[model samples]
Target: MTTQMIIRLDSETKTKLTKLAQAEGKNTSQVVRELIEDYIQNRDMGSYIDDLWDRLGKKLKARNVGSREIERAIYESRASKK
Candidate 1:
């Protein structure tokens, strides 16, 4: 089932949107719907991204460092170079 709704835009915006829709071989509504959908999805995904970042940070902290004194080892390695 489908229902029709009306939207208002300034004339300059409408002209640009119409040309973009035509160039993409889609009607104005289809292009607008896709842009609106992407906007909504990106906004909604922010919380999920924060949770994933926390999980990744924990994993990185847990990973082993090869040498007991990492900074000293790096300075020694660098000094040995020509």
Candidate 2:
């Protein structure tokens, strides 16, 4: 069940969208739908970052690497650049 949406775009934006659609062999509506879906998926990036950090912590723990060691290595690396 899909609802029809009416949007207003300026001529230049509409033209660019139409060209992009044609280049991708899609209609403007399909391209717009895909772009909207991508935007929706990435909107909750905080949760994504938290999950990423959790996974990284588990991996580091398995390798016996503590956060203090990681911070020291980062500090050393930054100091070497100066």
Candidate 3:
């Protein structure tokens, strides 16, 4: 689900943004969405960690490492900490 947000910008800024967005073959809203997504991806630690884990999972799968190996590793790691 998506919600609407209202932001206030000066005329000059709005005009420039519109022109740039057009030049990039996108609407102002798309540009704004991209900016917001990038901002969140940069500053959100949870998002960063989730992406990291996703990449790691992909690499492990590529190497044919299955859930059993992952579970064993996790169990071993926890045991080592005790």
List lDDT for all candidates, in order.
0.82, 0.93, 0.98
Candidate topping lDDT: 3
Best-to-worst ranking by lDDT: 3, 2, 1
Report the C-alpha displacement of residue 8, candidate 2, in angstroms. Answer: 1.0
Q: Model 2, which residues run further than 4 Å from truth?
A: 45-82
Across 5-76, the per-residue lDDT of candidate 1 in tens digits comes to: 799999999999999999999999999889977887778778679878788667756785434556777688
Residue 4 lDDT (model 2): 97
lDDT score of model 2? Answer: 0.93
Q: Least lDDT summed over 10 consecutive residues: which range in candidate 2?
A: 39-48
Instruction: Assess every candidate by TM-score.
Output: 0.50, 0.52, 0.74
C-alpha RMSD of each candidate structure in angstroms: 9.9, 6.8, 2.6
> What is the C-alpha lDDT profile of model 2 across 1-82, one tens digit per residue?
9999999999999999999899999999999899888887688788679889999889999999988999999999999999
Model 2 clash pairs are none
